[model samples]
Target: MSTVPIASSRSQWLPAYLALVVATSVATGVASWMFLPRPELGPLLLLCLMGILSFQIREPDVGLRISFSFLSIILLASAAIVGAFGAWLVGSVSMLIDRRQRRWTATMFNAAMSGFVGAAGAMVYAMLGGVEGSGTVGLSTVALARDLGWPLFAADVVACLLNAALLSGVIHFDQGIPFGVQVRRVLSGSGVAFVGYGIIGLLFVILWYPAGLGAFSALLVLAPLLAARWAFIQYGEELRSHERTIDTLVTALGTKEPAAVDRSRRAAVLAEWIAEELGLTPGQIGTVRYAATLHEIGHLGVATRLLRRSPASLSPTERRVIDGHCVVGARMIEGIDFLEDARSGIRHQHERFDGTGRPDGRAGQDIPIAARIVAVTTAIDDVIREPGAAPVVSIAEVARRLRGDPGRFDPDVVAAAVIALDKHGWPAGSPAPVAS
Candidate 1:
């Protein structure tokens, strides 16, 4: 099994990404010259402005980011209804004028890639038996829908794939992250938005055929367009708010037990490595990371006196008070809809494999897999961080303890952790494994 370091880091792959951008730009430019339509200054300028106003929407929780621009919808529709050349002109101009990309190289690349995407989509539409120009005027709604819908959908798919391929390639090279993971994140994050925009583009095609890009015709779409943009804005705000709340909680816990918080973060990194090694889905890995970070959140509710006292001298009641933090943390986050999966792990991180530990005593595979992973990772992190309590325990020592401790942790999880630890070049000596 291979392990990935969970720390966020980047490598220098700018030259490579820039080269790709240049290649794509030049290739698309040549293709555009061969097939793209002559410039239509009026609609082209409007589309460019719309593209400029469009922003990139990002949701880190789902590891997704996408550019949300009405210009794209309008341009795609114009491509299907008017011709590919108009879309090429508008998309190319918009990319060049995009002020957000400060670097000339990036700006040029964006323009080139977008122009290519638009051109490719137009070609696809034309190849799919789509009517050109005013020919779309006489078709019945059903005929238009059938003729236009599939081609538009296919074009949309091409646009998405091209965009994703270009961006994901850069990310993969620069960050050394998996390409599939980056692609999945990008698509999942914007899947609904992209589909909605595509549908809107189709609507634009239908209206433009009959109405001729007049004020009244454009006005017809304003309500729905505005509604869609507003919905996206609201959704972005909600995600940001949710993220802020998580940060606040983590900060609060850090204030209460700085070491514990640090330990939690380290555990999260290790757990991510183990989860990936175990072939968990990206979504599941995200949940594991969150759970690991908040695994010790229950410690925040423990009394200062209890924290200060040595564990060896703690009374039974004191131990119980300490042990109940999992339940407390779980309860605290149970109401949070986004943290639902995390809450389960937080609650069961203390549970043992042999029906002997925690609030619920489930044995072996009955325990939540996430909780089991967290337990193993947290235990290992605790040992690694412990100071002067014991001589630096070796990875072998850690594995030995896990193997020796009968049902304290899941063996499979423990095995994964050991492999990850070894693969990450975990220090030779660390503290003995701490009790969960």
Candidate 2:
């Protein structure tokens, strides 16, 4: 996430924000007039086709959610019609139509954003020496390739960057995250696909004008597109399946170790709150929750009787099993791609701030932040849920116990936990200190 903080209000960002709005409006208006009156039926149909092909993909583990509409429509408009104006109308109209059911603010924002992006692309194309309305640049393969390649590519790059910048700026303002983080997240999830689609769109328009394939070529690609959509759907389904499977395993473990179950749930809740207090992004919070929920999963591999016994009463061999649960639980989910971050958190949850942890002797800030937060939250839960203990404890006592062992947990995490616990009203009592 961005290390930079957001201003308390939107007016603080107004100067540059106003510039963007004005430039976008003027550019779009000019482009629209250049394209004139309205789009032909063929282009309108293409816009609808693009919308129908759009799909939403969400990966909860990594916290990435994206709605992807193949880049074909925008790219085609940029290459074929009245330069960028064609793209603007296609994107804005399609978005307005599709999002009509959404809140007015959301629908208008989307429509305006689309128009701005399209206008930016068209302006870039014209500036790059691409003539307006010369969709068909028919020449020999080499000549046409040499002529249109650079301008088209540049236009695509400009559009991509503009889209990223505008979106990232808005997100940064809203979420108080760094622009770089938002940009990196967007690129990692969708950049490559967008670029590839742009290339295909350029090729499609080339064929439309010269080969006379026209709009019918879209029909030829329909089967392949549908097939690709099916593959994406299958991939998304498997992602959901992975999440469900992990939940089931964790629930089963809880059933076997009923005491640990409540503690785990509490740990998960506190960990998420602490993460938020520490300015972790939503994706990071999700990963922390998973790690906290399954940190004790290694206990599943140990004997049930052994788990029920107090840690101090365990034999050396039994202690080893207990110590090794982190590794065991991490191994179980290591192979799943999305849980890569969570695996590290689980493996290191037992590590001490002073190099006194198991599986590894890592120390200080070297520990994963998620793991550190989990350790503090888990400790709090353990203290409150001690057998025969009341559901309540002084928030001060909880803080003292957590801070009392600086060698065991990260101080920063402990501090965040204190604030988070107080904010969330933990220990099942008032925020004021009470006798333990």
Candidate 3:
């Protein structure tokens, strides 16, 4: 549904990939036009206009660079109404009118991908005996369902899968996200909505042909589509607000403990990688990210002098007060509804695997998983940023250091961190050789 632009620096294979997609799309469009019967000009043009309009109305997604739009429904309806060539035409032409400024490569890639997805869906529809262009007028509901329903559903499923694959392919190259991870993210986030879109497309087809409503069918469906878009826009806004709140808290913490600003963000990145490596659910992954980012927020309540002092110089009483920051941080966000699950993580992040850690001495798996992951990630970040440490620590050295601590950290979480760091390497400013 979207095409992310690759950075110019990492674009070695991008031009070749875009060229291949565009070429494949053109070949499919030409071959379908040459072999298939032409669809009616009126319906074809109307559907193309609908497709263009749908593409223009897009909502930003929080988890992806891609935007969500009703273009899929239009593409599905085009496949059911107009055979392969017309569907391809609708899709390719829809990308020509964009409101946002974008690179030529992005436009070309999106147009080509849309065209391919449409043509492929239409081909699947035809292969399953779907008749195009006003052929459903005389059939009873049962007969219509038999001939049109299954084929359209199959085509819809194929279109969704093909679209996800194409989008994932581009994202993998552009953003360095593993293709399998991107695919799973897409499926988990939008699979149900796609099924709903298929049903909407089917209704549009039924209204256009069987009920003789023609283009008015589009108008009839416009309200619900816009309502859905509006709802998602609101959800996106709420997520942005949550981000702003986190920023405010982080900024406040930075005022008291400047080292925390960058450390929290770095810990967040590492924690998310480790959570993914451990195959945690997406919701749990999000909680881990939040916990890691705010793990040191307790520093806000500690004295500035205490935080600035070297660890070896701190008195036991002062250290105990410093340790209570975890508890203090948990209470600070207790009123935040969305952060409720993260409270336990912040509260328990200082807990050790061997039951000797600060405040409450909860050990092993008795500690929240988010806390355990955050503990390892924050330690990794601390070591990477440690004063007098090597300019660039190797992954093996980092792993060795983690293992050197023994029962201080959760062994499983430590292993997951090592594997994740080895596979992905550390982020910028914390360079480490990928482990062999």
Question: Which residue pairs in candidate 1 have backbone atoms (N, alpha carbon, C) closer than 3 angstroms, thus clashing?
Answer: 37-85, 392-430, 393-430
TM-score of 3: 0.90
Model 1 accuracy (lDDT, Cα): 0.68
For model 3, the local distance difference test gives 0.81
lDDT of 1 by residue, 1-436 (tens): 0001122324466566667666766676566667665545665555555544442321213233344455557557756654676666566776666444556665666666677667777778888877655667778778787678788888887777766666666656555445676666556556556655788777776776654663344567756666766766676677678668777888898887776656766777788777756767667877888888888888888997898788888999999999899999998887788889888888988899989988888778888878999999877766666556455677887788778887798888898888877656452333434342
Return the TM-score for each candidate structure: 0.79, 0.70, 0.90
User: Which ten contiguous residues of candidate 3 have the minimum total lDDT?
Assistant: 2-11
lDDT of 2: 0.64
Name the 10 consecutive residues with the lowest summed lDDT in model 1.
1-10
lDDT to native, each model: 0.68, 0.64, 0.81
**Best-matching candidate per TM-score:** 3
Candidate RMSDs in order:
5.7, 6.5, 2.7
What does candidate 2's lDDT look like per residue over 109-181, in tens digits? 5555666666667666666766444445556676556455556676677666666676567655554335666
